[model samples]
Structures are given as structure tokens and as C-alpha cells.
Target: MSGKLARLQQQHDSLQQEHKALQQTKNQLNQELQSIQRTASNAIRISNERNDLRKQVADLTRNVADLRQQNRDLSNESNRDWFLIGAAVVIAGILIGLLLPHLRFQRRRNNWGAL
Candidate 1:
């Protein structure tokens, strides 16, 4: 009877040791899972920030393109204005050159009649 009791006690001690080891393993696995959750959260935040920055960059690029087009349009308008002014000045110079000789001949005739 004593031998039977000793064997039962040994079996109970082994079962207890296995249960303790399983509990330790469960605790380690829980800690690892929590660490993974934190890492996933950080990754999600970084991805969202990257997406927002990309949107901002796209908007800025569009704005720059629009401004460049406006600048080109303004430059074309200025060039057209200068061309018109130059053409008008040339026409006025030609009219004055043609008219001045006729006026000088008329003045010479009027002076000879007075003499």
C-alpha cells in the first residue's frame, strides 16, 4: 500500500510540472501577440501618413503646372501688345515722310507769289 501511494504522488508531481510549463508558454505567447499588435498599429499609422503626403504632393504639382500656364499666357499677351505698338509707330513714320515734301512745295509757291 505504501508503494502504491508513492507512485500516485510521483504522477501528481509530474502533472503539476507540465501544467506550470504550459502556463509559462501561454504567457510568452500572449506577450509576443501584444508586441505584434503594437507593430501593426504603427505600420498602419505610417501608411496613412504616406498617403496624405502623396496627396499633398499631387496637389502642389497641379498648382505649379497651372501657374506655369498662366505665366506663358501673360508673356504671350505682352509680346502681342509690343508688336502692335511697333507697327503703329512705323505707319505713322511713313505718313509723315510722304506728307512733309508736299507741304514744303506748297510753301515755296506761296512765297514766290508774294515776291
Candidate 2:
């Protein structure tokens, strides 16, 4: 009877020790899981920020392209305007040159007939 009682007490003590150890392991695992959850949350936030930056970069790229096109169009228009101005100046010079000679000849003829 004494041996059976001792055996039963030993078994109970062993089970208690095992339960304590298992509880410790469970607490450690829960802490590790919480740390992993925090890491995952940070990763998701960084990924969303990265995606937003990419969209901004894409929009800026398109804006730059549009600005470049506008600059080229303005340059072409300026060049055309300068060309037209130059043509107008040349035409005016030719008209002045031809009209001045004709006026001088007519005045000289009218003076000779008076002489």
C-alpha cells in the first residue's frame, strides 16, 4: 500500500511539471506570433507606400513628356513667325527700291519739258 501511494504521487508530480513546461512553451510561441504579426503589418505598410510612389513617378513621367511636347510646339511656332517677318521685310525692301527709281525718272522728265 505504501509503494502504490508513492507511485501515484510521483506520477502526479511528473504530470504537473510537464504541464508547466508546456505552458511556458505556449507563452513563448504566442510572443513570437505577436512579433511576426507586427513585422507583417510593417511590411504591408511599406508595400503600399512603394505602390503609391510608383504611381506618382508614372504621373510625373507623363507630365514631363507633355511639357516637352509643348516646348517643341512653341519653338516651331516661334521659328515660323520669324520666317514670316523676314519675308515681309524683304518684300518691303523690293517695293521701295522699284518705286524710288520710277519717281526719280518721272520728276526729271517733267523738269526737261519745262526747260
Residue lDDT tens for model 2, 1-115 = 9999999999999999999999999999999999999999999999999999999999999999999999999999999999999999999999999899788453445566676
Cα lDDT over the full model 2: 0.96
Q: Candidate 2 versus the native: TM-score?
A: 0.81
Identify the runs in model 1 with alpha carbons over 4 angstroms from their true place.
105-115
lDDT of 1 at 50: 99
- The stretch of ten residues in a row with the least summed lDDT in candidate 1 is 104-113
Residue runs of model 2 more than 4 Å from their true location after superposition = 105-115
Give the top-scoring candidate (TM-score).
Answer: 2
- Best-fitting candidate, scored by lDDT: 2
- Cα RMSDs, all models: 4.0, 4.1
Q: How many clashes show up per model? A: 0, 0
RMSD of candidate 1 to true structure, Å: 4.0
Task: For residues 6-104, write the lDDT of model 1, one tens digit per residue.
Answer: 999999999999999999999999999999999999999999999999999999999999999999999999999999999999999999999988885
